[model samples]
Target: MENNIASTDNDQRVRGYCAYDWGKSAFETSVTTAIFPAWFAYLFMEANGISMKVLGSEWTADAMFSAAVMIGALFVAICAPSLGVIADRRMIKMWWLRVLTILGSVSCILLALSPYLGVSVGWIWAMIMFMAANVGLNGAGVFYNALLPHMGDESEMDAISNKAFASGYLGGGLLLLVHLLMVTFIVDESGSVQSWVIPFAMASSGIWWLGFAQMTFKMVPEPHIENEMEPMGLIASTKMALGEVKKTLMGIKEFRTLFIYMIAYFCFIDGINSVTALSGVFGIVVLGLTVSGLIATILIIQFVAAPAAIGFTKLAEKWGTKKALQFSLVCWCFVIVGALSFAPLELENHDEYDIQYTWDEGNNTYVATAREGVNNIAALPDDGEQQWALEYEDILPVAENEDYDGGYAVKWAYEKDGTPTQVAVSLNATSLAALEGTMDESRFSYSISGGEFANSTGLGVEHPTSLGDGKLDFIPKTARSLVWEPLGLSVFFQFLLLGVFGGALLGGSQGLARSMFGQMVPETRSAEFFGFFGFFGKVAALLGPLIYSLMTVWFDSRVGIFAISLLIVAGAIILRNVDVEDGIAVAKAEDERNRASA
Candidate 1:
């Protein structure tokens, strides 16, 4: 009966643990990846008009977002070790987890107020709230990950860890899909989406996170502390925690392979995480994709990643965990390289036509008058072949003219191959005269469109080729033309395709990496060691974004992106040297020693 009861409890605990991932993933997907970044970008654009002055330097919305994430990560890196030690010494892991979850959820909910805060300070408030929420999310993750060793044995670690990641993807993806639908359908009178809809989506993510975490609170029991220290005041406990951390640092050679793995993890995970965090912002700023497009792409990643994570467990079993992980890292390198070359095509053709205007002295306004017989005309150099064309909207005059109707002729001039080919769309003289008459009355608006002209000119607008006029301006422009444009695919399709490839590797890499670490960490000191694990990860997280931000500010975002690829490569090379069997042996021996001493 006792054995059955214990089995049931373990099963419940595993489910509960996975539930926490499901809960928190809402925050990651809806708030971090999908909605908040785009909403913040919109707010920043509305307030500061594309760039903001920071420290007397003009910074783009993406750079500021990266900086905010860097600050939060740096703060958590400094605190994770001591916090980890305290949780190890006391029965405080669950309590700390709860506290951090509340902090994160509340901060996320409060973000809805950003729209009401006035444009001048709305983005500023949003950034501060986002930073606080990130601190909570990252801080909670330290304690959350520490529970892995206690939940299952080494043999089951990969399955259990990957299952949690899969659960997270499903939970996060579902919510993001719902939010995407909401944003897509909710439009204002102008057919543009209402800005407030996104902020509401952000709040919903926090609510989802907090609401689902109750399962974890109810089912996962706080682990018992072995060799428990006597209760002390906060300051005393902090000092003791610091001393314990120092001892572990000094004894690092005892687990040399583990430490070596941590160093490699620190390097590579930084690159992985930075790519994940900045992808939405990158799309908005660089690719010029809409929020809906970014959300759709992230949703694709989430659904693909959930199943991919489970598939990786099988791969880990057949190929060994470390080898499987290395494969994913190689895939990541390719993804990043592909991202650096992702130049989006400008499909929309909206050119400013040179329309001649005369100042109307009679009404104190500018009158757009016809250069020839037509009031508004677009003239292109026509070749002998009927390749070039002009398209414009049907015109309507405020006043009726008997001699003119809203019809235009396609008159094209300039000959090729000794052929005078002239096609022009024109308005009748009376309507043209009326259009000029109503120019001062604010009663007319005009628009133009043409696809053949764009095709003939080969003038699709591309993203800026130079990474700004800076130190890296000398870097050759490789991503000037859209890579997939020749195939007649939208840039969003490219992002969707990339997301699938990235998604397949995302959860697999992280899940297997964490599982491998859990297998090598002594269960007796799980929290303490996992704290150091979080410390390394959080600290590593700091460097990637900081480097990316600095590179972006000093040179350009492209250089920043290129710089991240180098970290992943360097880390992968170092990871090849770590001996997994030796690390596992040391972990088992340490656990045995601890049990004997106790």
Candidate 2:
């Protein structure tokens, strides 16, 4: 029975990693990337608009989202280290994961109710829920990541970590696709889904939580030496944690590099995140794309890129992590450039003829064709008239009750075509130069058809017109004709190459770090130090969003994102410099020095 129990425990530990991957995937995709942001924006748009004191008092939905992320980051930074310490103290680690996972998952389920809440209350609730969920997700991730050193041999760490990341990408992508299908195809006309959607999502998360909770309870053994020897009180514990954190900071040799790298990561990642948040919004507002179009586009990106992200690992192994990461950064640069190429201002105001009025019996209204003609008239929305009779009531005379109908009543023609059309006549330089009455085809092309006019003639307009610019413009001309615009085949190819190669390098390095930890730290301090690792990594969380947010606001979202690429670039540079064998040697020397001093 003891052997069986041990066997089960071993199995649970392995499965725990898988559960962690699944849970994080679900949490991030359902709550973070896919549904929540979109829904938040929808609510914000409905509640008048998203207003921030930051962005010139104007409404920017992206700013609000960024603000929420920053607030969440702050919360994570404060609690993560303390929680990490607390988890190591007793068998409470499983309990923390269980409780917090529930908290996070439940909050996510509540998000489905957002559409029903109406804008004001709903938006606030969403912000709160999102913040709460992120905290839980990050907190749980800290513990889960720490479990890595315990799960595998030192050498397998890279492959394991990379595999875990790949799993997360796949799992999250799958769930997102499912959710999108329901929203897109199954929802009713009122834009509401069958009540089952929320319940199913809630159930999925609950199942995920429950399955993982069991794994944690079974696999991660209680710390061998739980500080049962007069554990500090809660208040005292906080102080103890704070003191230890200070010591950890002061004692670590490469602390400067770690902190600087974290800062750089924070700065550049923020830029990337900001652009991501704003991309769909920019498309909607600036490009006149429908909401459906934007959603479809994002979905397309995920579907196309998930395999690419996974494949990137292989490329990383072949090329090296640093090169791959640098390449991904470059791809991001082009994505930004392509996105901003057609700023909203560049879109010329073209004609969309929506008929606002109709005419009736015997009215002589001056409807222009070339400059003034009858065929140019667009029928009113409700009008079914084949030949609209010009009524006296429809005509607005210059003088009230003045008889233009009595004098040489202006003879006019009414077209009989059932379909409405518009003939746009602009008095621009080209038209002016052509002479008032001379018929000349301008750069914009249009075909005019009307039967019954005294002179029924065809007008040839220009096929395309040049707008306010020289060939050599300040803004780089996008490869507009290409389907992906800035993200052409080459950029995509580069993204694949870099993402694969870099992912492998980072994955391998992270694996190696965990392996070294296993060899160096005693089993008792392993979890605690892993907690410290969380603190170290998450320090970037607060600043990452801040940098991204500020850069986006400062230099437009694209340039801001370009700035973020510097993080991966910098991380690669610093990571390469972190001589692993040397690090181990130094660490051993420091440990001996401490022992001698004692």
lDDT of each: 0.74, 0.48
RMSD of each: 11.3, 11.4
User: Which candidate has the top score in lDDT?
Assistant: 1
Tens-place lDDT per residue, model 1, 1-598, is 9999999999999999999999899888888766676678878877776576779997878788878887897888788888888887678889999999999888988988998989889999999999989999988898899999989888889988999999999999998888878877898764567877888887888888888889999999998766776789989988998998899899999989999999989989999988887787667666556566766778888999999999999999999889989999999998987776665553333222212333334554333322121222211123221111221222221111222212212432223222222223344445444444433422112323322122111121222221334344333233434245556555577678779999999999999999999989987778888888887887786688788889888877767888898888988998999999999999999888877886
Residue lDDT tens for model 2, 43-140 = 66556443435445754566677777767656766676666655555555666666767676677666656656765687777777777777777666
How much is the lDDT of residue 40 in candidate 2?
Answer: 71
TM-score of each: 0.75, 0.63
Write down the lDDT that model 2 would get: 0.48
**Model 1 off-target regions past 4 Å?**
1-4, 41-64, 116-125, 192-196, 281-290, 340-490, 546-562
